[model samples]
Each structure stands twice: as structure tokens, then as C-alpha cells.
Target chain A: MLHTYLLSIQDQDPTKPLESFGEKLSYGGQMLLLGMATVFAVLCILWACLVIFKMLFHDLPAKKTKTADTVEQTVTEPVVEQTDDGEIIAAIAAAIAMAESECEHVKFRVVSFRRK
Target chain B: MLDAIKNFLGTTGVAQLFADSNWWQYLVMYVIVGVLFYLAIVKKYEPLLLMPIAFGMLLANLPGADLIHLDFFFDDYYISVEGGKIVGTLANDFTQFLQAIPNALYSITDSSIVFDFSEATLASAGTTMDAVNATFQEFLGNAATLTDGALHIKMSHVIKEVINNGGLVDILYLGVKLGVYPSLIFLGVGAMTDFTPLIANPKSLLMGAGAQLGVFAAFFFALFLGFSPMEAGAIGIIGGADGPTAILVTKELAPHLLGAIAIAAYSYMALIPIIQPPFMRLLTTEKERKIKMTNLRTVSKVEKVVFPIIVTAIVCLVIPAAAPLVGFLMLGNLFNVSGVSDRLSKTAQNELINIVTIFLGVSVGATANAENFLKPQTLYIIALGLCAFIISTCGGLITGKIMCKLSGGKINPLIGSAGVSAVPMAARVAQDEGRKADPSNFLLMHAMGPNVAGVIGSAVAAGVFLSFFA
Candidate 1:
């Protein structure tokens, strides 16, 4: 019954000002119901689509397994140790010196090597 | 030399104000502008937009500044064109038509015509039909025609006049009137917002929709208060708690009410941290407030990328009127989530939105001249806007309570208030309340689901109003 009223109200031109108090009341009521219903309906449809997206993209477990497998392989793999090359060490020192020269107000020394 | 000095003095703003009967009104406007400045600066309330808006008000109210002429935009004149030429005698609605003629001339010629007629020319022609006709004939020349096909002049034509002759702020106001700035701001909001929580819990969208209670409720109240349907719709949108959406809806539905509605919407939005918490506590039990739901699942990159696309298609399909706002919003989100358009995303989120915000704020502010801002309806709008915000908060809380019961006490009702869509502020209030209740509960992520959903919900509500009224 309310649906029929909504349909009827929808047909009326909303821009026209309601002259009678009762007509304005009725129209306002119709607008409230219609506006709420439409807002919910649109969002609900979006909600349903998101749910479908969740179902379609349910590859989380597969991706997790792949990541786990990579971790395992990395742990089992042998770590290669390399002796420091004099040329590379000297280049790194020169770069640090250049940087230090640019910021002459600050003094610093290379304390240790860290891999990030 | 003495006569020339006296003439210049007569033309000064001080003399104009002294001669005008409504000088007190300008003083009142200055006080209001000062209050707005205090709110924007000292109180630190939404200052990014508020400061510009207040300054714009100051500009508009300064005596004899001539910065904005509201009469230029008034919908009082009609154009009758025959064979692509204007037909009306200048004597008929001539004063009103003078304001519209530049625009009409631009429309017909497809180029702006400089209106260089001296004030003396207009004054001499005065209300004499033959004299005014001769003046128009001199101006229009071959462009003038005589017949009768009446058509209401379009707003675009009105805007053309502003472009040709309106002051700086008046030209900038075109963005608000044409519905450009709001949609662009939405694009930036989309880029900045994260939809992960919403994607993890799609049901949160319902809570967002529930929060719209205030909008429709306010509309009903405004209508009961004897505001026209268009005015009521504009008033009701203050509940959306989304500033751009309110501005967009008000601009289209009731441009006359734009200043009052924009002030109400933004002020209420800034006050959300204060306005929403009481309603939140009143609507939910301490037990319901402490009930923390499980953590949301991590949304994958693929899902995030697909979310905006799917939402744009679904929403625009259902409510095509929402396409301008929703479409740009999704496009912005897609730019952010796509992970490949970092520069574009950064620009939209920062530079583009900032520039548009200044333009949107000041122009909207310029609309609030003494005549419009000092009205009784402005007070009604402010009151109704507060009612809308409170009711919306309650609506979200009520929905949260319902969902809590349905979910067997897994959902915390406090998070529901975040559905009012004041963005992170509403979500933060929910978190603050949750922490006070349980000391360890973290509702921020959970609340965000509904927080972002409220943005979409409000946009959709605006769309419904546009479809109904625009």
C-alpha cells in the first residue's frame, strides 16, 4: 500500500509548492519515506556487490600459502658470504666524505654497517 | 578645485554609508563577519574553508565595495526571442532586462559583449519607452528583432552576465552555481579516503543509510515550518553531514538559500565532535558500547581496485543523477587504489582540492550579504540543521543497537554514530567513547566502515533529492 503511494507521489512534480497544509504534510511524508528507501536500496545494492567481490576474491588462503612457501624456501637456502672488496669500501668512504663535506656543520663517523 | 574635492568626497564609501538608510545593517554584517573570523581563527574550527568564507563575507559587506551584486543573479526577468533575436521593448521589464541583456547578448552572439554604456545614458533614457527603445536600438543595432516567443532565461545566461560584468567573487561563484567545485572536492575526498573497512564489512553500508534519518526528518520539519519543497530539500541535506554534498544539493535545489545552508552544514560538521557524542551515549547502553566486533579481514589489492569501479557502476546505474559526484569520487578512488597513478592521486588529494576549496568557500561566503544572512530563515536553517545532525546520529546509533542484537552482541553500537560521516572525526569520537567504556576496545577500524559508507550514503541522498527536485 505504501509502495503505491510512493509511486503516485513520484509522479507529482516535487518542485511545485504545496498550497494546502495537508498536501504539504502528505508530500513531506512521502519524500521522507521515498528518500530513505532509495538511500538504503542503493547502499544495499552496493553492499551486495561488495559481498560478491569478497566471494570472487577469496584467494587469500592461496596467497598466504604461496608466501609461506617462499618463506620456507628462503630459510632453507644457503646464505652466501662475501669478503669486502677494497674498491667498493673505498668508494663508500668517498661518498660519505662527499656527503659530510656538503653538511660541514655536522660531524659524524660511520660506526657500523646496517642492511635495511 | 573645491567643487571637484566635494564631488570626490560624495563618491567615497563613507559618504555612501552616511547617506544610506541601512548603514546600521552594514555595521551588523561587520559584527557577524568578526564572529565568523573568531570561529575560524581562534576557535580553530574548520579554518581551511571557514577563514576564506568569513573573509568573503567581509568583502561582500564592506560599504560600497560593489564586490558582489545579488540582483544580477535574481530570476526576475524573462527573454522573448524571435528568429534568434531579442523581441521585448526595453520599456517592458527594462530595468530587470538591463541586468540580463549582457548575458542574452552573449548567448545570441556566442561571445561576450562589453557593456560600456555610461550611467548617464541609462539615466537619461529613464522610464521613457521611446528613449529606452532608442538606447537599446543603438546598442543592439541589427541584433534586435520584434516578435513573441517567450522563454525563461537559463542560469547559464545569467552566469554569462556575471562573467562579463560581476566582481571577482561573483565570477568565482559560478563554480558553485554550475555544480563544479563540490564534485571536484569529492574527487579529492575519494583519493584521500580508504574503503578497506567498508569492503571487509559490507553490512556497514546499511548503518550509513540509517544515518540519513536526520536528512529526511529535517526535510519534513522544514516543510511543516512552511518552507517550500525546494527549500526544505536544501535544508534537509544539512543532515548528510557532508559539506560538498550539501552545497551541491542546495545550489541546485535552492540557490537563494546556499549561503545559509553552507554555513549551517559546515558549522555543524565542525561541531560533530561535540554534537554526536551525547546522542551516541544516550542511544546506546554502556554494555552495547563496549561490545567489540572481531577484526576486519585484510582487503586484497585486487578487491580494493575493483571496489570503486563496481560502486561507480552500481550507484550511477541506480541513480544517474548522482553520476557527477559519485563518478568523480570513484575515479579519484581508482586513481589512488590503482597504485599506478601516484602523481595524479597526490595532485587530486592536495593541490587540486586546496585550490578549489578556497574558490568554493569564498564564493559561497560572498552569497551571505547582510540582506540574506540576517534573515529569520537563516536562524531556522541553523536550528533545523542542528536537529538534522542530532537525529542522524541517533538514527545511526539506533541502527547500531539493532545490528548488535541481530549479531548476538558482537557489534558495538558506538561505532554506529560514525555513520553520520564527519569522516575521521566521527570515527574518532566513537573510538574515544569505546575506550572510555572498555579501556581496551579499539573501534576505529570498525567504525571507519560505516564512516566511509556515510559519505556514499549522503551522496546518494543528495542524488535522490536532485532527481526529485532538480
Candidate 2:
């Protein structure tokens, strides 16, 4: 079965010449036109499909952005803890100092302290 | 002892070369092999494939090393079988039939024969089995009738012969002949390829298609040079700038020219850096080259996963003949982008591709024996192959210029040359030229869009040829 198939591929003898130069030329021209045309058409269709995909999936990244904003909000909220009042005051002062050092123009202060 | 020494000397390769009339051909082949080795090892021009191919050529040309017998594959060799018994050889020509009959009889009876027959009787008879059998009956007088008019030689018989009598390379060559190795290589290529750039910018696909201008151009030129249509089609595919695609097409359309076409395709591909730059510069102005366009949009994971599926469906539907090459290619790509089959993807990308490359390179190299490679037409194929590469670069550049104009100078004309499908190499050349025009202008990612698209484009072009001619 394998040999039969291999032989079938070889059946078209490459040595056999066509009848005339005119026929060869005509065939060559036709193939050139047909080959180029088919390639362009197929790729063009693929291009159109990609364009549609972009449109369909356009909103996905935006949804991802909304989730990212919620994560940011949760990260920025302060955590409450049972501790000494003095320790809390000292922690706030150190945090303000670090923030002020990073941004030289900004001044930070503790507005209020509560035990929770 | 003296007689034994004489016999040994008579069987040696040196003795064979001295006795053969065409000894110079072998010497020339050796020099060609040496040059290829120098290119592969010293120049570092696709060393992985070129080294194996060069060595295979050397092995084939060795005087006394009967590593491959081209006649077994060529010459329309066939055998007829009847009721599971080996019958007579089926050859259209009387001379070939007569030459093959002895072997056929030996395979069947497992005994030697001393038979006499007049050539005049067989020559006068027609080539049909009935006519030949009648002639044989007259010679043997009472021998049993042979054959059932089935003309094909069973592949099993050929495989048995290869295992029993053929060389190592012959066994390996079956993969190339059956069109298995190239497609498998594409599978690996697909696993390694990233279609993100192409997916991000879909317009690059048109540039890829435009770059195929050289494929048809070379086809027409080859036809004018007196190659048969099939041979021309095989030669023309060298323009695709993809070696496996060229090899698969050539093996199917013109197996005899595989060696020449393969060598030409690879050598020209290695020379792309030199061959494409002049055309890229000649076709596009400085202003056009410096045009750094907007960045490609980010392709979502969902789009990446769906890209290969859509391409495979549309391309296979449009050109069914392209399915083997294109289907395997997309399958490989899917394995890569799907992100689920990491193990299968890794194996295809590394071990599978490497093994097939060695087999494909060497077997394809084995086809370049003295008679096939040392022809005036080989020179034509080499020249036409260079022309194909140059024209393809120009094709891409021209399309790039048109796209630049149409998009109101938002596109860089330099990126067009990447559509010739030399992968990242062609794209890098575009980036280099673009940077020379303006240091800050980056075209690598932009050019990659067209570079990957060119891979698909060339595969489609190969399918078109197969559909028309195969």
C-alpha cells in the first residue's frame, strides 16, 4: 500500500515535456495569476476575521482594569489592631516621616487615633 | 595468498575509481562536498542541516560504497503478484523487463536458472503481459503461466528489499519520499512559533501574500527555460524561503530535483541578509524607511488561542491540498498557544524537530548524486533561486510602500521585506535598516507580524501548486 502511494506520486514524470512552448507559457501565466490571487484572497479573508475578533474581544481588557481598581481600593484601606495608644502614635509618626522623605514637597500629619 | 591479495585489491574503492570512466565526477563531487562543509562549519551558515547534508553527499559519492541505488526508486520499477505468489516483473520496455525477470524468478524460486531466449522474439511482441507471457511460453515450451495483469509493485516488497539489501540512508529516505519528515518538522516549527505579532496586526497578512510574487515569477522563468511544468513548480517554490515547504513540494512534483532545489533554497535562505538589504534599500526611500508606525494592539489570550483554529479552518477549506503542511503547522501552533499541553509542545519544539531535521537533511542530501546534482540545470536552479529571493524581497517592499501610502505614512515601508518568511531574520533585517534611518525607530515587533504571516503565505502558495499540479 505504501509503495503504491509512493509510485502514484512519481507517476508524473518530470522529464516529459509539454507539447509546445506556447502551451507552457500559457500555463505558467495562468498559474502565476491564479496562485497570487488565491494567496491574496485567503489571507484577506483571514485579515477580515482577525478584525472581527479584535472588535468582539475589545472590552475584555477594560473589565480587567475595573478588577484592578477594586484591588487598589482594598490595598489602600487601613488595618485596625488591638495595641497600646503610644505604639500607635509612634507608628503613625514613623509612617509620616517615611512618606515625607520619599516625596520632599509633601507634609504628612496624624489627624485622629481610635482603638478598634 | 597472492591470488587472495589480487582479489581483495580488485574489490577495493581505489580500484573501482581507477577502472570507471567517470572518475572525475566523483572527484568534483568531493570538492563540492568540501566547500559545503566549509560553509557549514567555518561560515556558520545553517550548520545544523548543511553539515548532515554535506556528509550524506560524501557518503553517496564514495566509489565502492553502495549506500543508495537511485535506480531502485527511479526507472518505473514494478512487480505483479498473484494469489500471494510472486509473479513476473511488469516493465513497459522489453529491455527493462528482460533485465528484471531474472531477479523476479530468483525471488520466487530461490534457485538459479540457466535460460536461453532470442531477443528478436520478445522485441517483436507487444509490451502487454499477455504478449510477453506468450513469448515466454514459446521459450520455456511448457513452463507455468505467470502474472495476473496487476501492474503495481507492493510497498511491502519494497520495504523488505530495503531492509534486506538497501543501505541505512535508504531506510531513512522513506520518510522524505512518503512526505512525513517535512510535515513533522512543521509541527515542531509551529510549537516554537509565536503568532502574537501576526494576531496583533492582521494587515500584515497581505504583505505576506504579496511577498509570494517571486514564487510565480520563478515558476514562469523556469518554464521558459524548458523545465516541465511539474519541475518548474518544484523549482519555483524555492522562493517561498521556507525549506520544508520547498522540500515537500519538490519531492512530490520532481523528486529527481530534490537535491538541487533543497540546496538552492537553503543556501539562498542563508544569504537573505545580503540578498534582501539591497532590494529593501533600492525600493524604499529614506523617508519611507524611517516611518515608525503606531504600536500593535495587545492580543488577548483568547484571540491567541483562536488564531490557529481559524487559520487552519479557512486555509484548509480554501486549499485542501495544503492541509498536510498547513494543518500540521497550525496544530503545532495550537499546542503552543493553548498553554495546556506544555509537555507535548516542548517535545514537538525540541526533540521531534531535531530528529526530523537530521533525517530530512541527510536523505535530501543523499539525492544529490553526481548525475542529478552535476547538471547545467542545477546551475539554472541556483540562479533562479537567487532571483526568486530578490524578487520576493522587492515584492514585500513594494507592498509595504503601498500600505504606507494608503495608511497616510503611518506604516514603515521597511517592514514589508519581512514578509519573505525567513522568520525573525527577515524581520531583523527590516529593524536594522529602520534603525539606520533613525536610531529610535523600532520595527522588530512590527516586522514580526509580517514575518510570521509570510510563513502561512508560503505554505498556502505551496498548497496552490500541489492543488494545480499534484
Candidate 3:
């Protein structure tokens, strides 16, 4: 009776293996690394496509010779200056002023030189 | 004693100072000191910055010394006290000063609004009765004290509370931390930029795009090096070589990396004159460098206004992460183009930019605490950052070469390296280097297109990284 009760009470199953929680955690980690690697691979592909586009379209032949016409249309009066320094400075100042007029944030004044 | 003598000399002046030190350590120290002295005295690569950075390197490398301690600002605390009782507080004097200055500036703006006294307050407080009482007291031989009859609470306190609660520091931080100010700085940048040369040649924009290849390349490299996507993204933005853009991207992705990335970006920028010229000259022959660009065409004012809005809509829609930066930049540009809100534009340009700059510089500098900075990883990051810049420059130049070949020698590959968005500096370098190769070559006008385009490209790259990572 005792031997029969012991055999019945043990209820041991030899077919199934015990699984630890660490194995589960490692499985999650592996999945995460895989996901990241996949994302990086995709980005790299997109980057390659961009590089191809830049290379292909960078230099198309210039057909129209509109340089002279554009030059004539946009030409403005050149200012007279007293000296070489004045002319160079005035040109820079005018250029800066034009840039500022367009962009509006840059204020460049000639701090040292007095304008006549 | 002899060994000690050797140690001192080996550590600083001579090899004997490092007699007890390992051979490699002595070599590194000597090389660092020598390079520092050269840069400080000769190259003058930001004497203020390099000087401190060099000194920091020296201080850090010194054995058994805490002089390079990073705890000076971190360990201290500042708190406001009224009548020996603690009231308001901050962690550092910098934050306290940052708070105080803004409040002081605001109160002083319309001095009358804050200071003007009303007769009603005096009347309500019975000031006239108090004066009459004072006369009666004088007659009775005891002077009346003006304390009890009339009392007034200054509105300055109210303003202080409002400004403090509204957080002048936070708003100031918006400019510094969030890069709101630097975005506005684009206005000044815009005003200063000469797109005519670029407009005369739009091909330069391709060079600009080429330069941005470094930013994207850095992202991929960082990923391979085991940085998390977010960190890799933040680190890669350094390739942009634009401080504001770096700050903007880092603030969103990895705020912790802000200080390192900002320092790296700015340091590389200032070092461009030194770092880039050698490479440019090395990569190209004298003939290649001397490729003269055609004269640039005049850009219409209408085109300028449309450019910003179009860029904003397209970029923001495509990369929503870059909206804050690209939005503010275009808005600032719009102000300049519209010419309607001159005052608002001026304020954005000067006062706003200035206020933001000081705060941004100091706060970003302060973020470099010893704990965050003294890691082996930081060394790697700095090295990677330098490599990224060099690689990007090479990438752009190489791409430019391909384009030049494709274009049948019409395009100057030199300007393509300026694509890194160091702005006018990079463009100017290309121009200067081009002239050195051939005095008549004018690449500045052509380089501007790519230089400006590099800005947009870096921002877009940053946007792309942020979108995927953040």
C-alpha cells in the first residue's frame, strides 16, 4: 500500500523540461537587437538611393546663353568712391545692405570708417 | 628625491618629470602640451576655447592632482534668503544671474510703468493726514514717524513673481536649450549670406548636399559602433558642424549629449580653417582647385520670400521632427523678406539672438560636468566626431569629383566640401583655397549655393534621424 501510494504521490513527468525565466529575458533581448539591425539596414538603403540621385542629376548641360541678357537686365549703377579703400568698403557695405534687405537679420555697419 | 625630481620634470617641462610615469603617458602629455602651445600662440584656434580645453587636458592628465576637478559648480547650491530666512533658490549662481538679468531688463524697459506712483494710493493711505499729524507732532516736540499712515507695495515684486513663474530662465533656456535663439540667428546669417554667387550657380547646392553626406554617414557609423539609435542620431548631428542645429536635434533626442555635441560642433567649426585647408589641398591638384566659376545671376526679391516658405512647407511636411528649427528659420527669413515687421525682425535678429547666445553659450558650457565628461566614452565620441567631420569633407569632395567628371570639368569640386553648413566660413574657405590655386578663380559665389544647401541637408538628415530614433 505504501509503495503504491508513493508512486502515485510523486507524479513525476520525465518528458517535460523545466524552463528558467532568464531564458525568456534573453529571448526578448535577441528580438530587440534584431529589430534595431533591421531598422539600420533600411536607413542605409534609403541613403544609398539619395547618393545615386545626387550623382545622376548633378550636371545637366547648360543650353541657354542668357548670361548677357540677364546681365543687361539686372545691371545697376556703380557708385563713385574717392579712394580704393572707399570703393572696396562701399562695395562690401552695399552688398551687405542688399543681403540684409533680402534676409533682414544681419546688421553690418562700418564701425571705424566714417561715410562721407 | 632624485626620482621625485624626475617626476616633476617629466610631468610638465621635460621627460625627467615623467620618470615614474609610463612612456606612453609622457608621450601623450608632451604631444598635448606642444599642440596646445602651438595652437594658443601660433594658430590661435579660439584662444578662449582652446586655451581652456587645452588647460583642461593638462589638468586632467596630471597624476594625483584634483585641480581638474569638475565639482566646482556642481557641488554648490544657491538659495535666496530674506531677513536671514531662506526664500527662493537655485543650484548655481549662473542660473541665479540668468534669472536676475532678464527680470532687471524687463523692469527697466518702461521705467515709468513700474515706478510711477499714483495719488490714489497716497490718498488711500492717508498721506496728507500723516503729513498733518507729523506737523502736529513737530509742534509737540516729538517727530512723527511716516510708518503707520501710508503703506505702498511696489509693483516691481509683482513683475518679479510673474517673470520668475513664467520662468525667464525657461524662456531663456528655450533659446539656449531648445535652439530657438540659434534658429533666429539664421536671420543674421541670412542677411550676412551672399546667395548671389550661388544663385549665379545653383549647382553649388549639390555641393552643399554632398557635405551633408557626412551627417548621414556619421549616423550609420555611430550605429555600427553600438550607440543606441537616439544617441547615434545625436552624435551624428555633429557632422552638420552647425551649433544651433546640433543643439536643436540633441535637445530632442538625447539632451544629455547636448554639451559634448555642441562643444564638438563649435570646436570643429573654428578648427575648419586649419583642418579643412590641408585636406582640400591634399585631395585636389593645383589645376583642379583653380576651376573658376561663371558669374552668378541676380536673384529676385520675390524668389527670396518664396524660397523660405517653400522650404519650410516641404521640409516640415517631410521631416516633422525638424519643424521647430526649420519653422523658426523660415519665419525669421520671412520677416526679412516681408519688410513689414521691421521691429519684430530687428528684435529677433539682435536682442533676441544676443540674449539667447549668452545663455546658450554658458548653459551649454556648464552642462559639461565632470561626471558626464570624464568617461572613456567621451574620448571615443570626440574622436568619432573629428573623424566624422573629416569623412564628411572627403565625402563631399569625392562626390564633387564625380559631379565634376559628369559635368565635363565645368564644375569646381572644391566648393563641394563647403557643403557641411559651417555657413559663410566653409564657403569662404572654398573661395580662399580656390584663389590660392588660381588667383583669378572665384568659387565663393558658386560655393554659397552648396554652403546654404548644406544647411538644409544637415537639418534634413537630423530630421530623418530624429524621426526614426526619437
- The clash count for each model shown is 0, 0, 12
DockQ preference between candidates 1 and 3, better one: 1
Ranking by lDDT: 1, 2, 3
- Which regions in candidate 2 have their CA more than 4 angstroms from the true location? A1-15, A64-116, B79-157
Residue pairs whose backbone atoms clash in candidate 2: none
User: lDDT (0-100) at residue A50 of candidate 3?
Assistant: 36
By DockQ: ranked, best first:
1, 2, 3
Docking class of 1: acceptable
Q: List model 3 lDDT by residue over B128-178, tens digit each.
A: 444434443443212112233222222233233334443332334444443
Cα lDDT of model 2 by residue, B1-470, tens digit = 99999999999998998788988888999999998899899887778888888988988887788887654554244333345333343323333444544432223223222222345433443244455566555543132233442133445656666777788888898888788998999999899888877887899998999999999999989988888878988999999999999999998898899999998998888778789988888998988888977766667778888888999999999999888888999899999989899999999999999999999888888889987889999999999999889888888889988999999999898888999998767887887788779866767778888998899999999998898677
Ranking by TM-score: 1, 2, 3
For model 1, which pairs clash? none
lDDT of 2 at A93: 40
Each model's Cα RMSD = 11.9, 13.2, 20.3
Best by lDDT: 1
Tens digits of per-residue lDDT, candidate 1, B1-470, equal: 99999999998888988788888888888887888789889887789888888888888887789888766665432334445444443224433445534332223432222233345444553433344445555544333332221223457657767887789888888888889999999999999998988998898998999999999999999987778888899999999999999999998888889998998898888888789888888888888888877867767788999999999999999999898889989999999999999999999999999999999999999999888888899999999999999999998988888999999998998988999998877887888788779866767778888999999999999998988778
Error of 3 at A73 (Å): 18
- B437: Cα error in model 1, Å: 1.6
